[model samples]
Target: MADELIFYTNPMSRGRIARWMLEETGVPYKTEIMTFGGTMKSPEYLAVNPMGKVPAVRHGKTVVTECAAICAYLADAFPEADLAPTPDERGSYYRWMFFTAGPLEAAATNKALGFETPPDKARMAGYGRFADVMNTLEHAVSTTPYVAGDRFTAADVYVGSHIGWGLGFGTIEKRQAFVDYLGRVTDRPAHKRAVAIDDEAMKIAQ
Candidate 1:
C-alpha cells in the first residue's frame, strides 16, 4: 500500500495546482487524466467526485477533493516534505490559503466575466468586490516573503499559484507584490518540474 496514492486530473484544468503540490511533496502517485465532457462526466469519475471536478486525489481509502484541500492534505500526510506550517504559524497559513480558495477565486472569476458587485451591496459579496480582494492579497504578499511569513508552506502553493495564474491570464489585477511573490514561488525546482510536466502533457493533448 506504499504507492496507493491516486491522482485524477487534467492538464488543462485546475489540476495543475495539485500537480505542483504533488511534485513538491516528492510523492510517487498515479495520474489519471480526464477529459472535459467526456470521461470526466462518466459515472466512474463522478463517484470519485460527485461534482465531477478534476484535481481530486485518492489516498488509500481516503479521497480528497478541491485543489486547496488536496495540497493541504498532502502537506500533513507527507511531513517529510515540510510543507505544513508549525503550530504557531498555522493561523496565517490557514487564513491566506482559504482566502485564496474562496474570496479570491470568486472575485477574480466574477470580474473576468464582466460581473460587478453593486457598490452599495458590497456586504452581500463574499470578497466585498474584486478590488478589495486584490488589495488584501497585495498586502499579504507585500508584507511577507511568503503567505505564512518566512516559510514556504502549503499555503504558498495554493495562494501563489492563484496569483501566478491570475497575473498571466489577466484575470486578477497586477500588483508589484503579486509580481515579486510569483517570481519567488515559480522559481522553486518543484514548481518548475510540475510546470514542465504539465506543459508537455498539454502539448501532447493538443
Candidate 2:
C-alpha cells in the first residue's frame, strides 16, 4: 500500500521540525496548512488532534501527534531511507528525542520567561536542570558527529531540529556544538530541499 501522509501544520510552529524530517525521509506528502486565530480550533482539524496543535502527521490510518513522535514514526515507517536507528540504539535514540521535548523545552521555556531551575531538585526533572540540560546537550553534541554516533539516525533529525530552532528563535545561545550541529544537519540535501519549499511558500505568502 502506498503511504499516504497528511501533515497538518502551521508555518510559525513546531511543525517545521516534522517538515524537515519528512524531507530527510525523501517521501512525498500532502500538506494541510492551518492558520491561527481560529483555523486550528475548527472541528475538522480538532478531530485529528484534540490539542489542536500543528506538526501532526496522519500516515495512512495511523495518527501521530507531537513533533518527536512524528519524527520517529516517519523514520520507522520508511525504513528504506536508512534513517531509523537500529534496535541497539533505540534507548539513546529515545533519550535525546524526549530530552528535546521534555527538558529542552522546559528549560528554554523557563529561561524565556526569566525563570531558573532551583539546584536542589533540578535533577528531578527529565532534563536535570537548565544548566545541566545545556551541559548534557553540549557534551552529547560536541563529542559525537551525530546523536547516535558516527552514523546519522532519526534521533539526529529531532535533536538537530531542536538545536536549529533554538538558535534561530534566540531561545538558546549559539554555542559551538549547537552551531556546528545545526550547520551539519542543515547541510543535508533533504534539508536544503525542505527549506526551499518552505521558503517559496513564505515568499508567496508575502
Largest lDDT belongs to which candidate? 1
For residues 15-101, what per-residue lDDT tens digits would candidate 1 score against the true structure?
999999999999898988888888889999999999988989999999999999998999999999999988887988899999999
- lDDT tens string, model 2, 52-164? 77879998899999988998898889999898778887777787878888888888888789887678877666666677778888887877788777777778888988888
Residue 41 in candidate 2, Cα distance off native in Å: 0.7
TM-score of 1: 0.97
Candidate models: Cα lDDT each: 0.90, 0.81
Clash pairs for candidate 2? none
| TM-score per candidate, chains pooled | 0.97, 0.92
